[model samples]
Target: MAMIEISGLLLLLLTIFLAGGVWIAISLMACGWVAMQFVAGGIPAGAVLATTIWGNSASWTLAALPLFIWMGEILYRTKLSEEMFRGLAPWLNWLPGRLMHVNVLACGIFGSVSGSSAATCATVAKIALPELKKRGYDEKLALGSLAGAGTLGILIPPSITMVVYAVAANVSIIQIFLAGFLPGLLVMVLYSGYIIVWHMLNPDKSPPPEPAMPFRQKLKESAQLIPCMLLIALVFLSLLLGWATATECAAWGVLGSFGIAWWSGTLTKEAFWQSVMGTTRITCMIMLILAGASFMSTSMAYTGIPLALAAWVDSLHLSPYALIAALTVMYIVLGTALDGISMIVLTTAIVIPMIKSAGFDLVWFGIFLVLIVEMAEVSPPVGFNLFVLQTMSGKDSNTVALAALPFFFLLVAAVAIITIFPQIVMILPEMAFPPQ
Candidate 1:
């Protein structure tokens, strides 16, 4: 009877999601309330609901999101993207994919310092897209590459998503970072592989420069990129070596990014003001969604919906693999309607507990979850990356959407590697973590 009721409640929730005329949080709350009516006889909905909603919102770790976002905004508004590319272009500029390679690599480097994927996509695209188009590169490659590569921002260290995951699951954030490194590199290499292989197969599609620069010139040009690399290292140490909390580490990155610009004579008062304004705007948007998600998750727990669903799933006795597979599919679906951060909030809250209850390592599972969430950020039907790419380039949105398909598959494979080989995700953190 519990199984039958759980099935009925799941269907009702699905109907609310698919009903098409309401906000997701509203729908979630409505469905959750309905579940309460069916499943819980004793609790007061309003009291339980308020407590659940406000409970997680009060976590101090959430402060990192807005701070990290502000850091990325400062970088973007200060034209760090321009500096990043100008610095790296010399070394990578002669390759077949040429500037596209620099674009991807620059985003990858920026990813090390900034934890916001949309900001990485928007900031990189805003600076690089026009220049790539001018150099006669394929629009598909230009936009698709930016959108896909930007996904790395969250998977690499200084990742806001990982911090939230650590807070949510009570795991070490350092462990999350160490585990994230290999998969992040794996994704980068795969993206580079796509660029190289795609150009190799279709030379016409990815044009080369008329006169490639000499190796020495390229080497000299790359000298400019060294400062940015140093910035990445300093920020990484602050957070990873226990010198700073994620928020303080992000503060260091924000100051350092601005300091470099000022010292280099690129950061003017005008630029600084613009950076602060942009940071304020973007940070507010993120925090609002996070707050709403907190409330909605609260409602779900208060309403007894999670308990109802968990009880139903437990009775099934399904293999862990099957359960995980279903959850991934649901994430892909939710990805269409939700931004990566919001998706993580809603899904991870509901699902992570279930996976842990089923005996999966939260550490390993967190890596898998983060990578998958990154993939959703770049996917179509609501991919924030796609919109950012389109807005930056003012070109074919459809083409960018289609081009991102290959990288999406690459993400699937990466998730599979982490899923099947939990050691791949755990080894670094296990080795790097200070004895606690």
Candidate 2:
């Protein structure tokens, strides 16, 4: 059979399995089985499947996923978001957007710890929406800003999405984490900048500025944030300074999260078990998906699908920029249906080769992939962040989707900026772990 025919057959099987409501992991495994059975008839598909799943599952680096997830789960049960709001509001009052900027800053802060976009959105929105609404802030702006900023969860350090991308791309987890920092900050600045411009044009829409806060009073109000700040410093600084590996840092993060929850009096027996259970469920789902993706990737390799696809892309003779433009559109379309992690795992086997063939750095592309995933978090239909805000705001999906539209474009702009100025994504990783 021709490569195109085989690839199309595998694609059809995958689509059919997924459309039939099979679990994503099973769907992937089923597709892999069909490919190996029909296309590579001599190989023992069952043994290959077992070994591939084991190899992917037993990765020490992959240990970071659950620890980071547990940390986020524990902190989500605490009053961290409430404290963030209280601490950040006084500082952000001078900004043109006033307290609305809290959504951006708070999401960034909480996202560093949480790593999950939906969790960050839900945690921050739980505290921010009611407060913003009560303060007479415009509902649309408040909801939209939260929907937009919430995506920072995956772009910042310790991101769950970044961890998955790093493992899949066979790059340094720390390098990917470092690469994401500046781009994440860039997106935040863009979001806040848009908020400022919006407020400037429609000053009447913004609430009156709160009274200037005394420095000491501000300090006192922000004291509750010291622990969270210290935790962030502990996890990130260890990674940056080479004191701990990503997994070690994640372990430390979990310990710090427990301490914070205890100090906040939210670490009750019930909360602890709930966090553990949440961690298990999320970890299991991700691990299964990784295993299935690994098996599928192995099957594709045996059948030469990835190399064939890469050669096809090369034959098109597209410029690097044009290739990136095409990929951005492809990912955006994928985003409309699939969640971010699935997008990364499903495509990396095919996409990474194309990117490498184009001479693009995997670490830089990891950040780019993450930024695109962040956009997916806000994309309609399956956009988890949109669903999060909708549930909290008691609004329909369209309202939440509309609110997130501008930020969606802002993410696209971030993608373009990084594509043109590739240095923005590479500088930190290069500085931290320079080429020999």
Q: Which structure among the candidates has the greatest lDDT?
A: 2
lDDT of 1 at 406: 83
Candidate 1 regions with alpha-carbon error over 4 angstroms: 1-55, 93-96, 209-216, 295-299, 302-304, 434-436
Q: Candidate 1 — which pairs collide?
A: 52-298, 53-298
- Residue 244 of model 1: what lDDT? 80
lDDT of 2: 0.91
lDDT of 1 by residue, 39-149 (tens): 555656667657766775676666676667666666666676777787777677556676778777888888887777887887778778778877788877777788889
lDDT of each: 0.73, 0.91
As a whole number from 0 to 100, the lDDT of residue 301 in candidate 1 is: 63
* TM-score per candidate: 0.87, 0.99
Model number with the top TM-score: 2
lDDT of 2 by residue, 236-305 (tens): 8998889999999999999999998888877888888988999999999999999999999999888888
Q: Which stretches of candidate 2 lie over 4 Å from their true place?
A: none
